[model samples]
Target: MYRVQTSLTLLLSLATAIAGSVVHHDDSFQPDHILRVTAQNYTEACTTRYSVLVNGTSPGPELRLTEGQVSWIRVYNDMKDDNTTIHWHGLTAFTAPFSDGTPAASQWPIPAGHFFDYEVKPGIGTAGTYFYHSHVGFQAVTAKGPLIVDSNDDPPFGYHEERTIMLSDFFNETDKKIIDGLTSSPFKWSGETSAILVNGQSRQRTNSTGSCQLASICIEPGLSYRLRFIGATALSFLSLSIESHDLSIIEADGHYTKPLNTSFLQIGSGQRYSVLLKAKSEAVLKRAGKRQFYIQITTLERPKTLTNYAVLHYSSGTPADLTTVPLSPPLPTAKTVQGWLDHKLECLHPDHAFPTLNEVTRRIIIDVHQNVSDHVIWLQNGYDWVQSFPQSPYLVDIYTGRLDTGGLYQRAISQGHGFDNITRTFPARIGEVLEIVWQNRGTFTNGGLDVHPFHAHGRHFYDIGGGDGEYNATSNEERLKSSRPIQRDTSMLYRYREKTTPLAPSGWRAWRVRVTEAGVWMFHCHVLQHMVMGMQTVFIFGDRNDVMAQSDPVDAGYLTYGGSAYGNTTHSPVVRQYFD
Candidate 1:
């Protein structure tokens, strides 16, 4: 688990940089922050409409955290119409399961004008790039921001400065408009993005973006800067590259990875990465007559492409001739994606290496499909995520003896369309090692390049291996021999380019996890529209008693809103924004 040392001699030496490779638990983080959720008129891409905001900002505020520290964030829902719940995306919420902030599965969405306090407790070794976004509905399109969890010690890599390059897709239409179209009776699909945004900075959609007011990051010569990249898009998969700079990826989704050097970096929705970018010396900048460089981000996977840029500005140099920074946007293909999945992102932590177990306690292979029956729908393991009415938060209900495992399984068998053996809720005993495989099918490679980025809530998993078509355990055995499984909170399942087999599965990605956390955690496609169409499910690790013992009190604000615990007595605004 050797980390790549920066070649820049101005940075820390190899020994100094690698000394912090072994992450230690720190319990000193005690941050108490307040996030006021409100809806206001926000203008982006020549459109002004009411969009969700946190603390009066569209992208919210950067939340700084420390590993092993339990922080409290009180969120006041100032919005007058919509419900809001903040999912501390990528934070394990290891100590308190209810703090996961998922509606119905974890807790109720905080009603309008109400407030809920979230407890963020990242495990000792779980500190890195993460984000927090509204988990309610389409609000996440504009209501999210960067979340960085620093380790107790210095990072294993040397850097003089760090910056966040949060990439997002912008639509001319409002979030409400898109949500309406996707949920309509006939199911009109939400179209492609109008423009790509880098750190919420982009120009109006036009024929050319050369005059765009791009996001800027200041830098000093001879210094290494850590760029924390977050993919906060609603539907866009993106590829980014810097002018004359090769990215040395040091971390992904809070897990340290052996530095992966690449010219182009692809990011899926809900995923995060920390890459080291060394600034050229002042003398080099002076000689090249360039103090500014372009950080180009282009939309990938889909048919049309939208490209945006950000600038890396040096502190001391003659004004850079910005016009001279050439941009040769790479043409992304299925091969590019396959190369990424095939290349192992080895863990830097020695203790977190790929396991050598002969077997697992449970193995599940789920077929993912987008089907159209009475209406367009997305299915996960053959079940719609939405529970039938008399619906309540599973955390509360399961603990109250209202939801038995047998009854829940029976309900799934009766209502679901396929995989009666697997239900919406996959229950596993605590401490059991489990392997989950996702099989994507019925997608054409000719024109449809729908990449599904799966996000895991409450915990991360070791990504063992993935490939095109159906999953074969015998064949996977060969992959295990060569794969250096990396732990990640989110990973993309690429679409296979196979026009010959129209009905064959496009791809498969497998995750091996040791169920140590006790919560009904969600595993779903990061595409917001797909999740709205019911492409989601929960994994119940440990029993009801186990979750209840670790969850917030039954009378907590989040639990009482829309949750069955006090639905008859409480008075909160009812919300039916999300699919489930």
Candidate 2:
């Protein structure tokens, strides 16, 4: 009996080794492309702005790749003084989390006049409209572009043509000035956006009279068009719509979803959506006698009511001339605007069922609030994130036993809320399912009810459920159960209502993620102002044994390259060429 059992075990081990060898020997992989992105100053958008241009363009160059194919991109920082890093915003680097492009967490920022090679191999299921942007400072507000991944197979739906619409809220003030005001005493928030842009162009209205030179899309009357909408704003939640059309949402943040039709879309910062818009029939356009329709974008936040407009022209023959197109209609009325708001009060993404969650192994509850000492600062679980140096990154510290586990706390004392506080990090293990509940606690001065878009690095999560009020396991049972929840990397946490007669519940958002990657990942508010004010935290996945076993040799090589200073021209050949 013992000899029979031993024979069976030996055969099983041999079969496993053969399977592993087959995977390792696969030779159908494509060669990597080295993308040289340069950061420089450019005069654009009716102002001489200090912008980060990728390959000399404000929107940079489009990076096209097939899904599941490994890519090697080398970004060269040519900015005279600023430091930067390019984050593959929606790609989950899987077991290779070090390439996630989060400064101070996975790796250090690429210094001026240096280069960093990012090796990204997005997992099998991630394919759709994703983008790349600077992860450090305010560079993302300017230096950004589309990173589209085509599926190995055709999409479930059909489209005749495609267009990429990158949305941003432009400000006349420089990034440095905006940071100074945000971090100053009495804490000044960015009041309102000076201009809103679609595809890097907008009509610069001068005294209510200006030529409409905004981005215009020429389309045939009866074709289906796929419009990829990316909200890369620094501080704006936009309500976007077309004059006479409905948007059929097919994908969100690189994940395919069930088709959902909506008249308007509420896009927060760092969010992306691919919607299909079928143009009006040729007969419909001929009868109307107009080939143009207005694409309106309005800010949902305060300072004042602001609106931007673009044109979508449909023609069966030659493209219509811009000068002949009629002016767009006036802005919607207050009542009409309120009706749109009412329609989206649920704050759910267009598709409510998809990418269901597994059984949760751990649960984390975080309280988000604002604190004022010398200046206003945003906090997560009573702690704010401070950027650490590149040489002593969060992952390296944790791996080398430099991090003190005893000092990690769930909440910070009000007296110890200053800059001297140690960094806060949460620990998890690989393969463990985690449920994070983000509860919005009202702010210090204001009613505390403000919308915040939460973004996570490395991987997407299932947005299981959310509701207005504090999260209670018992009272909020139904909201948590969903068979097909939307899977996304960025989600909006709406504000709680002020308690008038009866106490209102605080707003809460809950998401579930399985820890498949083995590195430090950052979760923070997508609003650049709020992120700089310290509303962020890191999740250190895997223990010492697990991390060491899954470590990537490629990450170590990049770390050594990133650590070499530019002044040491003799020692670093890459830096000497760029600097000289």
- Candidate 2 lDDT (Cα, 0 to 1): 0.66
> Against the true structure, what is every candidate's RMSD?
9.4, 7.6
lDDT winner among the candidates?
1
Pairs that collide in candidate 1 are: none
Each model's lDDT comes to 0.70, 0.66
lDDT of 2 by residue, 100-171 (tens): 778788766777777665656666767688888888877777888888888888876799999899888777
* Candidate 1 C-alpha lDDT tens digits along 1-580: 1111122321222112111011111234222887888888876544566788888876889999888776767677887878888898988645354567788787777777666556576778877888999887788888888888878998888888899888887776677888778778877878888777777776533435345455677888899989999999988888888877888989988888888888878899998989998889878887988677777777777777667667778876355433332344433332245637454677786653344545465567777776664367776655667523127777767766676755554443354321333345776655556678888777332223357899998768888778887888788878777767888888988876633243367788988876655677889998888888778877776666555444422443334554422122144222111100
Report the number of backbone clashes for model 1: 0
TM-score of each: 0.84, 0.82
lDDT of 1 at 187: 78
Model 2: residues with Cα > 4 Å off, grouped in runs:
1-40, 207-212, 316-358, 389-391, 404-422, 480-483, 496-505, 552-561, 564-580
